[model samples]
Target: MFLPAVVLGALVLACLVSLGTGAADLGLADLFSGSDDSSRILLVSRVPRTLAAVLAGSGVAVAGSVMQMSMHNRFVSPTTAGTSQFALVGLLAVALLAPATSVMGKMLVASACAVAGSGLLLRLLHLLPARRTPADVTVPLIGLMLGGVVEAGTTFVAWRYDLLQSLGSWTAGDLSRVLAGRYELLWVVAALALALYLAADHLTVAGLGEDAATGLGLSYRLVVDLAVAAAVMTAVSVVVVGTLPFLGLVVPNAASRICGDNLRRALPVVAAGGALLTVVCDVVGRLVHYPYEISVTVIMGVVGAGAFIVIILRGVDRA
Candidate 1:
């Protein structure tokens, strides 16, 4: 009870701070003052940015949680599994081939590619000889290599097409550019979250193992596919905002530590924690340099990297 209240309060505070901290100063007075600049900034920039951060953070965190549960590996996530890189490849192709495509069309293409990439990773994991090596060690390594390969291909394509600069923005998760029309796709994360909640029990059961899920009369493959689809869509849709590194890993792991492995009970907490952490990071990015903002991607990279190291160390200790 107390934990939920604290997280909710922090989330609210983060939203408020995100709304006020930007190039243009805004306050409660400014919000209601009818000043054109303040109103425009609020409507066009701050609100959208806040929403994007919250939604992206929540979506990515939930996706990470689902990935860990279904894959039975904590390190595997959209970032580690090459989902973002694959999405970038699709985004680059669309940009080059169909430059006039709508944002939704681009996202659809990206989501498809992301799903493919994640599916390939899953296949690789399945093919790995569990008798030869532990999965916890193998899965993340495979994912990293896969992501590197996809990233290299994306870089090559972007370089060839002179779209490296554009690709750079997508690779770096930055909420600074979020605007009303541009950031609306992130709201799809909300629906995705709702769907995850609805299927939380099935997902949890699926995580127990195929035989166990089958014993429970649940289609293990179907539940995994649904979970993967939700995660891929959540990850790919947030490409407009930029890639959030380690967010899925760190947040879900943290949530699991605090709340345990019961997906039905833990999913909402993980989402809220993700949203809070992201908003706080965004706020820190704004205030760290003061006036000139550091991108949230940069901040999260440093922070997430540190957190990941800690998680690994803890895992080793447990082993």
Candidate 2:
């Protein structure tokens, strides 16, 4: 609780910083009151991008935490594996199939499809011989293979239709173009995060292992479904805002190290940690090249992957 509060406080601070420091260089005063252009850019552009980072960060981090718990492994997440790619495939499919659809409608379709794809993979895992190894590692491996297959299809289609540039733009993490009306759709993901928060206890119990959760009279499959739902929400949010790399896998593990793996207790902490990391990364992205900003995806892919490697090595050494 203390950890989460502190982290969330830091998250708020990071958000304020992100809102204030940007290409336009607005002070705290300007954030509150300024010219119409300043207000529009601050309220419409900066606010939405900040919100997107926070919401997307929270969503991915919580999903990764639940996924790690559910599978009893730390190596799994949409970003680590290929689940995010599959979700991207879903988003591209929607774009190709329904060009007239609203962004919210596209997000819904992509999210549902991603969840279904993940569900299919889960079912297939259940039907397998049930290896004793942690599901996190194995599930991500499977997801990677599945994502490769899906990406191939997406690549072929995009090339065939000359939509590769547009598809590429969507896959890269860039919040520079975020606007008021367009960004509101991500609040649906916020709602989904709230649901996961409410069900945290059940999820933690289920993460103990299927047999234990079953012994406790919780429906194991239902809890698994909920976790998948959370993952889909995370993936869809990423798809909506382009890909964010390390927030999911890194934040939750950090939270658990501080908060003792109690899902109800850790969820908020993980969310805060995620948001903090994302905002910091965004700030760094803006500062790294001045007017030419780098994407958070690249920053995380480089730094976050290094951090992940260190953590994994530490775990291996402890074992």
Candidate 3:
């Protein structure tokens, strides 16, 4: 209760800061001035951008938490486990093959690919000892290696098809160009994040592995459902806002450390933490190079990488 309260409050504050922290001259105070340009910018740009950050953040974090719980591994996520790269491949494939494919069509294909990627990673993990101490590190490395291979392949294909520059946009996680209409699809992610609560209890049990779930009479269907939910969430996030590297991994691990093993309990904390981290990272990106902007991916890579190390060294090791 205490942790969730704190995180939610921080998330609200971070969101307010995000709305005002952009390059355009806008602030919460502007809401009182009634300036049309400020109102326009707030509605057209900052509002959309802030919503995008929050939606993408919560979506990816919950997806990551579900994946970790489903597989009983804390370190694996769409970024580390090749799911985002696979989504990228699917999106690229659609762009190249069906030039007439609509945005919704691209999301469907990308989500299917992300599901396959997640399933493949889960199968591979089964071949390893489940939840061993060494596995805490080994699992992510294997997933990252798998992702690297897939990403390299995607890069080659995109280059051959002369879509490398376009690929750069989806892979880079930039929020600078997000306008109102452009980011409306992210609301789908918000809805998906909410659905996690419905399945939280089952996922927590299934995450304990087959024997434990069976002993408790928890249907394996919940496991597959969780996987699909996470995959779709991951795919939608990548398609809309580019891949926010380490967001899923960093936030959930932080939540688990504070909130313990209960999925239902930890989930709110994960969502808020995810939103806060993203909003803060974006604000830092805007301020770090005033007048110019850095990509949120760049900011997150530095910040999340440091947090990832702390989690591995202190959080997991101590646990």
Candidate 4:
């Protein structure tokens, strides 16, 4: 109860700060005062940024939880598993091949690529016998290597087409550009979260070995596919906002540590934690430089990487 209260409080504080700390000076009072400039800025920029952060953060964290459960590995995430890179590649391809494509079309292509990349990663993992190499060690290494390869391809293409700067912006994970029309895609994340919550029981059951899940009347393959799709879609959808490094890894792992692995009970908590953390990071980014903002991606990279190192050390200690 106390923990939830604290998280909620932090989220509220972060939202408030995010709302008030932009180029335009606005506050809760101004929102109701009906001043056009304040209201316009509030509605147009601040609100969208706050909402995008929460939705993207929660969705990615939930996706990470699903990935860990379905893959039965803690280290696998969009960032680790090359899913984001695949999405990037898709987005780049769309830009090069059909520069006039709508944002939705680009997102669809990117999501399809993400799903395919996840399937390939899973296939590779399956090919490596667990008896020969421990999954905990091999899974993330394979994912990182795959991600590196995909990232290299994206970089090469972007450079060849003189779109390196554009690709850099897309991958930077900054909420500063989140305005009304630009941030609408993040709402899909809300729908995905709802789907994940409804399917929580099946996902939990599927986390048990495939044979065990089949014995329990679960369609293991179908559940796995659904989980992978949800995870990849949630991840790729947030690409418009920027890549959040280690967010899925740290948030879900923390939730499991506190609330256990029961997806039904843990999903909401993980979502809330992820949202709160992202807002806090965004707020910090806003204030850390005063008038000039640091990208949320940079802050999360440092903080999330630290949290990840701690998680890894703890795992080593337990082993």
Candidate 5:
């Protein structure tokens, strides 16, 4: 709770910094007066960008936390293991299936496809012989292979249709295009949050392994289905935002270190940490290049990859 409060405060401070400090700087007084063009820029451009960063960060982080807990794996996430890739496959299928559909329609198709793909992947896991090793290690490796296959398929389709550039756009996340009507789809984040919150207890119990959860009279399959649904919603959120890798893996782990592994208690803190980290990254990206903005994907990749390496090393040492 204390950590989350601090993250929330940091997020607030970052938002203010993003608003006031841009390529075209606007002073605090100038921002409040609302007369200057700078104020309008601040309101119209930076504010929306900041909000998008917050939404993307919070959504991905919380979703990742839930997913990691549900899977009982500290190393897995939508980004790390290719759930987002499959989600992109879903989005691409929608576009290919109906070339002229509305964005909402497209998102629906994508979400459904993502859910189906994820469900298939989960079921496929049942076929593999029980590993002597931890489920976490094997699950993500399988998911990575699955994601690679999906990506190859995506690439082939894009090449055939001459939509490679269009496909690439959704694969890499960018906030520059965020504005009034376009970003409302991000409200899926709110929906994901609500669903996960309601199911947190069930999810936690399910995380205790299937036999254990069944002993408690919980339907293991149903609980897992719900977790996958939550993950699918998360996949769609990241697909919409573009892929910001490591937000999920890092945020929940960091929160767990401070708050313990209780998903119900750790969720809000993880979400706040996710949002704060993203905003800080986005602001840093904008400032790093001055006139030209750096893609959040690039920035996160450099930072997230490093953090993940450290996590892996630490985990190995502890083992």
Candidate 6:
């Protein structure tokens, strides 16, 4: 109760700050006073952008948590674990092969690629020896290496086709252009969040490894469902707001540290904490350049890298 309250409060505060921090000269007071068309800005831009951040951030965080649990590794996420890279691949593919595709069409394609990527990762994981030593980075290292290879390939192809600029826009998260009609895909993300919450118990059991889960009468199929959910979560967020690097990775880790590994207990905090972190990053991005605006990806990369280092050191020390 206390933790959820704190996270939700922080989220609300961050959202308010986010709503008021953008360009076009809108303030919180202006929202109510309807000064300078601030109310219009609030509806058309600020509100949509903030909501997108919250939904995408929370969705990706939950996906990352599920990814970690299913794979029995704490270091992997949609960003670090090849999910977003494959999503990028799908987006680029759709752009190239089917330029006439709708937003939902692009999402479906990216999601399919993401799901295939996760499947490949699962198959690869089976070939590795199990260990949890302090130096054990087998899972994340492999996932990173996989994502790097795919990302490089995608980059090369995009470069060859002169789609690098377009690719960059798709990969770097920018909410400045997120207007009202552009962000409704996040409602689907909200639904995914609900699915994760409802299935939290099964996710918990499945996290104990397939053999354990099967012995405990948990259907192994839940692992597949978890993978699909994580993949879709990553894809939708990417399709809508671009890839928010290290967001999903670090947010779940923070939630686990605060509330232990239980999904039921940790999911709420993960959602709110992710939303807060993202909105705060967006605010930082907006403030750092003033009227020019920095991308959320830039701010997230800087902050998430620092947090990643801290997490690594802490995990090694504790192990």
Best by lDDT: 6
lDDT of 3 by residue, 1-319 (tens): 7878888888888888887877777778985577899888889998899999998998899888887777667887879888899999899999899979887888999999999988888788789865565237778888899899999999999999899998999899999988888888888887877888777888778866678788998887656566788889889888888999999998988888778778888888888888888889898999999868999999999999999888766646422
lDDT by residue for model 5 (1-319), tens: 5676788898899888877766775766666776769767875787777788888888888878777776667877776557788778877877787878877777777777667766766776778765423324677787778888888989999999988998888877787777655667777776777788788888888887888899999999888777665565666565567888888888877787778767788888887888888888887788898877888888888888898887776662111
Query: What is the per-residue lDDT of model 2 for residues 203-287, given as tens digits with 9 covering 90 to 100?
Result: 9888777888999999998887787666567666765678787667777776777777688888888877877888888888998
Off by over 4 Å in 5: 36-39, 129-136, 316-319
Highest TM-score: give the candidate number: 6
lDDT of 1: 0.83
lDDT of each: 0.83, 0.76, 0.84, 0.83, 0.76, 0.88
Say which prediction, candidate 1 or candidate 3, comes out ahead on lDDT: 3
Candidate 2 differs from the real structure by a C-alpha RMSD in angstroms, to one decimal, of 2.2
Off by over 4 Å in 3: 129-135, 315-319
Better of 2 and 3 by TM-score: 3
Off by over 4 Å in 1: 32-36, 130-135, 316-319
Worst 10 residues of 2 by lDDT: 310-319
How does candidate 3 fare on TM-score?
Answer: 0.94
TM-score of every model versus the real structure: 0.94, 0.92, 0.94, 0.95, 0.92, 0.96
Q: How well is each residue in 104-124 modelled by candidate 1, as lDDT tens digits?
A: 888888888888888888889
Which residue pairs clash within candidate 3?
Answer: none
